[model samples]
Target chain A: MGKYVSVRGWLECDESTINEVKKIRNDFTATYNEGLLGEDKLELYQSGWTFPEKQINWTAYVFYGADIREYHLDFMKKQLSEMANIQDITGYFLIDDHDGDYHLCWQIYENKFIESEQENIVFNK
Target chain B: MGKYVSVRGWLECDESTINEVKKIRNDFTATYNEGLLGEDKLELYQSGWTFPEKQINWTAYVFYGADIREYHLDFMKKQLSEMANIQDITGYFLIDDHDGDYHLCWQIYENKFIESEQENIVFNK
Candidate 1:
């Protein structure tokens, strides 16, 4: 099998965004059939939604044990980004990889997907 | 050596908070001398600040090749969270580990650091 990657992020928790994420969660992932999406191309765990009401409307979502081939992980991220408008979305995409486990961070600023320096956490097993 | 963990996160970008992070980064890491902090215990890379103006004042940050022994990584995280008031901070700690690279996400909501599901990105190598 291929190597594994972990994911975690935060977004504004609104009714529409929450519902859109819920739809994706339902549409993706396999129960007993073949694949979660179309064929049997990938397998991963996407966490449910939660409200923090921490100064801002926050919903912490997660996708663990993600398959990193053909940008499948990236595709899932794209789907989530579309859940709400850019103004309603102020989040980042932090993907860590090999050699030295360096983190590549991407964030939304003025409706553009910008890659810059930010902060995140990680634990190795 | 131990396995590697990747990190990427986002928070509000402010002059004071940015200055705090800049200080911590300076205090840690070994450029040429001995260890970063006090002794030769850990080796890590923490990224700098960036303003995205992405609807909200956003700063995407990162930590790569972090040392996890003796909770050094955890300590660094604690320091960063203290830079600003709870209302000015909103971030998630998505740590990835072995067996399947599962992500453990923790966030700050309502002035309390909460461990819940969130969204982020990861790429395996």
Candidate 2:
């Protein structure tokens, strides 16, 4: 039986920057040689793609050993920070015990720096 | 532009009871004469159908007049209670300003009666 950690995130970014942000996941997988489990691992549920005004909504899940969870989270944090136009990011984590059980454990959201930047961007606009 | 409320829920139920809970959505729609918009309105991302122990994950969004939001919430509460084998239900709400903006606002989860009931079921099994 394997213990798995699932991560889901909701983000807001410039419409032009969505595709670039998605590419980071692929790059991360290739660099580490350990990829997310399934086809839906990184699904972009919303992109403001169709509506142009709506923020982007994304969710991803990974199944890996418990010992490696922190490594993965750190990797994600670094990758997310590199995203140029991300105004806001709200994420949460879930765990699966491999015995048919899952639990949501934590959440993270945009910080003061991101908030101040967002304000500046909005004010400038 | 319109203002909208989004709802997301995570539930754990018996494998055999998945289909029954899904039908409640349809019944609600028919009774109200208002349907969830667009495709993927009620997406069942997980059902433990594959592993037999994982809980069910569901998410949905609706757009309508603000005056009717409470009416919809009360209606959902009634429908959810009618689910027979639901061990737990944790749900949250979000709001969209129709200007490409969204925010998560609230959450609800399983309670004591259901918790005790679930314990009995597990103990018996």
Candidate 3:
């Protein structure tokens, strides 16, 4: 039995906005020496995009390994809420391995509404 | 001056091959408690693809933060050479924040021939 997980989310923001947020978060982490949202996490990569010519904004991915639970999800939501100037969160995809198969869960946030669902999403070669 | 670096490489292999290689590498790490190729590294994610119907194979991305140098690149080449049945490395992308801007480099391996080049690859929001 092995455990591996990943989360991907896309955000709508400009380069300057993204850089500002990242700088703030990085400084906070350095000063506090604690993980974001009180959870041990590390950003893998954050990349900007230019698709449809001014339709899509920036996209970023973060990776962390810990017991996945409801508390962590709640914490993530609260932290995002506190951060200003962030909107239009398309959705979030969670991938975890359980019982020899990958399990996927999605949460979409639109118009201040949120919805959750589960599906079978596997990444195999 | 902040130093952040990332490397992206795509490999074309089958799912079973990817899983087998991952398991071997994981077990090796656990048993020996040493990084692959004598370098401290960690695999971020390995995902398969289905496109063009049996033409494209699996792809994987591994992330590790260390001082990027010639020795590490040489080590990576040697390790990949040792791994059998792995081929069709479309290319490898290197991104680093140098001089307050992002620098990009590319390497393509095809037909057993490798080419190196550089370009401006920025991921802005």
Candidate 4:
């Protein structure tokens, strides 16, 4: 069997803004690759296209691996939190494999949604 | 112009693990849709095909909208992090539009990389 996960969502922004974000993303990746494998491996990790085109729009970003473990999940959350803080993103969700049989998914909307959902879930409970 | 962004990276795992993550992702999206807009929207978000297929394996996941503001980037990071935690994903990167001119990209590896990078950067600085 193949282990895979897909994350899909929308970023409520305009074209110019999206382009700027892409540049930053590219730079960050370059920096990371440089830090990881030295300057030699940087080209290997550099993104091909400059603009966000093709299936990238309104499409799902997918990831695959051997098993979905707790450590992986925690790492993802921390990274996401850092990104959110850096970029100031508001809402999003993640769907990932859980254990070897079940799946787990969660969504983080704006603070308003969070507050409302928490209250609702609590009241319902 | 239209806004767009792409996030790409490899999930260091086996095939079975990838499939399991996909199922969880599908379910999570379904649940989010249900909670937000009722069950009707769930189908819209339910990922088709039972298994991971097509360009999903090694392709970049994309998102498009208006602008790449702090809020949007923050949201993407947080979502990615949460997914990482829930699914135990090890490594990943996100490329998004920033401001109205540049693009932003970042990578998050394991703790081993983090500690080493911090020390290396500190030494260099």
TM-score of decoy 3:
0.31
The parts of candidate 3 lying over 4 Å away from their true place are A1-125, B1-4, B20-71, B81-91, B95-97, B100-108, B111-115
Candidate 2 per-residue lDDT, tens place, B6-105, comes to: 3332333334444555666556544543454323322221110111123323221111112122234444445545542244433332333334333323
Question: Of the pair 2 and 4, which is ahead by TM-score?
Answer: 2
DockQ of each: 0.04, 0.06, 0.03, 0.05
2 or 3, which is superior by lDDT? Answer: 3
Error (Å) of candidate 4 at residue A113 is 45
- Model 2 residue runs over 4 Å out of place are A5-21, A29-31, A34-85, A94-106, A111-125, B1-6, B12-15, B33-71, B83-125
lDDT of 3 by residue, A26-122 (tens): 5544453334333233222111111112211122322211233332344334333433334443223333433535344433344232324332221
Model 1 lDDT, residue B5, Cα? 48
CA-lDDT, candidates in order = 0.41, 0.32, 0.33, 0.33
> In lDDT terms, how accurate is model 1?
0.41
Candidate 3, residues B28-120: lDDT per residue as tens digits? Answer: 444532243332332221111111112111223322222333323443343334333344332233434335343444333442324333322
Ranked by lDDT from best down, the candidates are 1, 4, 3, 2
lDDT of 1 by residue, B1-125 (tens): 44444343444334455455455555554342433344334332332122221111123232222314333446545655553343455455555554445465655444455554434443321
Candidate 4 on B1-125: residue-level lDDT in tens?
24433434333333455555565555555444312333533333232212323223343332222222232344444434444543333443334443323233343344111111111011001
Tens digits of per-residue lDDT, candidate 1, A1-125, equal 43434343444334445555556555554342333244434332332222322211123232222324333555555555554343444444555544435365655434455554435443321
Candidate 4: deviation at residue A14, Å? 18
The TM-score leader among the candidates is: 2
Pairs in steric clash, model 3? A48-B123, A48-B124, A124-B48, A125-B15
Candidate 4: list runs displaced more than 4 Å: A1-125, B1-5, B33-78, B86-88, B98-102, B111-125
Error of 4 at A39 (Å): 35
